[model samples]
Target: MSSGKEPANGTSGTVRRRTSTRSVTLRDVAAHAGVSSQTVSRVLRIPDEVAPHTRARVEEAIRECGYVPNLAARNLASNRSKIVATVIPSLSASVFSETLTGLSDVLAPEGYQLLLGYTDYDDEREEALIRSLVGRRPDGIVMTGAVHRETIVAMLRTARIPVVETWDWTDTPLDVLVGFSNERAMYEMVCQLHGAGYRRPCFVGSLPAGDHRARRRLAGFRRAAAEHWPGREPRVVDASGHPLTLESGARLLDVARGAHPEADVLVFSTDIFANGALLAAARRGLRVPEDIAVTGFGDFELSRMLHPGLTTVALPNATIGREAATLLLRRMRGERPTTRTIDLGFEIRRRGSA
Candidate 1:
């Protein structure tokens, strides 16, 4: 079906249709840009190698034709996906989202994309995500915590890709660790509360069995309570199977207050809980740090804005993300980092709430 007549403007000396059912190809871009197919390929693979004016013309042609480079074919040729897979517990929480922001800030400049997955604090769901993400052969993987099922660990080992575990510290990490000690941070928080003469402090948190970090925090609270108040059992209200939220926090506050009327301070595992408790107290017309004092972890922005600004443990959430990404990048480049574990530590911020 060759047209004997030349095309309008006589650019290629062949008749060309403006529209076609077939997908646009490199040759099509080349023809439209008035360049050879090789030049178009070079522009795609290494734009810096091509002259500026030629590169601009090819780039313009690409945009006009709506050409999408075949990433699968390109990856196969280069043996790299240029993608990083990250799995975290919750998307609703600002803690994880802030970390993701830091991760993106570092990864984006290097031309890497993130494949995100959320587990909602479920180990089995995390294991499933690990399996699926590993199957895709990403350049690297970043997980929320150091704890993982043995099968998941073995699968990642077999895959032999760079892996980074963040948000919780561990001496024996699966590959690399970038986080602070949850136990140490909570321990310091409790110690600070005790030092401030807040006796009969009660810990309110989610079920420890579901989250290792929460378990560590509970252990820290217990350790500090035992040391500070001898022979007195540490009061605790376990919000079993409840999602960490303002409503749950408010409900837990009522339960803790009812059960432990003698307790002077209520230390929550996260700011969401503590903030909820504050709201409940406000609604009930109770004065904070007089009727009861409240403290929380993850010094959220809302914590600072509350009627009585919350006293909480401030973690280096974004720094953890940036450090994890940096370590992953180093490992991906075949560099063996001498230090596999990094502990950024935490700070306890004292505010009107406590």
Candidate 2:
């Protein structure tokens, strides 16, 4: 029977009794498992701190009694909080969200909780968030975009937790990293555009801002243009990648149109900018791929659905997350994890737009 009432958890609806009569506590579980309170604490806080037999006994007791530890209280006793934190510059794009999905998928089965923080592209904010995450002393840390303040890098080096940096790659990594080649991806796109008969192309999007990945892509794009075209380097407008938004795309369209009237193609840093370019081009009465060809990164779903589907660089967002999380878990199990970086693959999406 369904009731419109709520339980003693405090609601105006009907209530149902819990399946178990007794509230499961750490002490109760310890007693049932024939272990001391201290042992149980050790088992929960740092399972590796206890012997295998003791851990098994504690876990068995937890399962049998349906015991749940108070996370807040448990965190205070040990340095390891058993929580994982992922700091993203922004979660607005489905790309980051998908990455987050992968992270959670891997962590959930291990009985560890994942926490999220958004720095909104502010370096100072990132520094602050890093401090907070460090204070919690989580078992693992996953960060988006490898660019970090020196203090944050030092902190991660000292925190001694399993750290996985994702979304972008550099020759050096803080620890384990799962990412795609942002610079090379852009380089490949630029070469493709040139071979496709784009003699005068202009790159659009925000400056790297505080984002090292976007900057690298920009650098690669410029390099390709300068190398292939020689004296005809593509025109570029640097928007701030820090507060990256679709609105920046509008500005990009105007800037490209005004500065490089001879441009036959425009390379945008992301789908958001690409979409804006599309709208701006339409409003300016320019035909896509005819008067002006547009290309974007991060082949989001909307890229295909739009008129004259956007040609873009597709990043394996979910795959990066899954791989990063998996790596962290392996490290947490005391396995010696090698390879600080994992470069997931990406591709160029050819569409009607370019």
Winning model by TM-score: 1
Candidate 2: C-alpha RMSD after superposition: 7.4
lDDT of each: 0.89, 0.82
After superposition, which runs of candidate 2 have C-alpha atoms over 4 Å from their true positions? 1-68, 75-79, 241-243
For candidate 2, write residues 75-170 as lDDT tens digits: 676545778998998878888999889888988977788889998777889989989988877888899888889988888788788888888877
Question: Candidate 1 lDDT, tens digit per residue, 1-354?
Answer: 986765543265342444667777787788878889899999988889999999998898888777888888999898999999999988888989999999999999887999999987788888899999999999999999888888899999999999999999899998989999999989999999988989889999986443888889998999999999989889998886567789988888899999999999999999999999999999989899899999999999899999799999999989988999999999999999889899899999999998
What is the lDDT for 4 in model 2? 55
Name the 10 consecutive residues with the lowest summed lDDT in model 1: 8-17
- TM-score for candidate 1, residues paired by index: 0.93
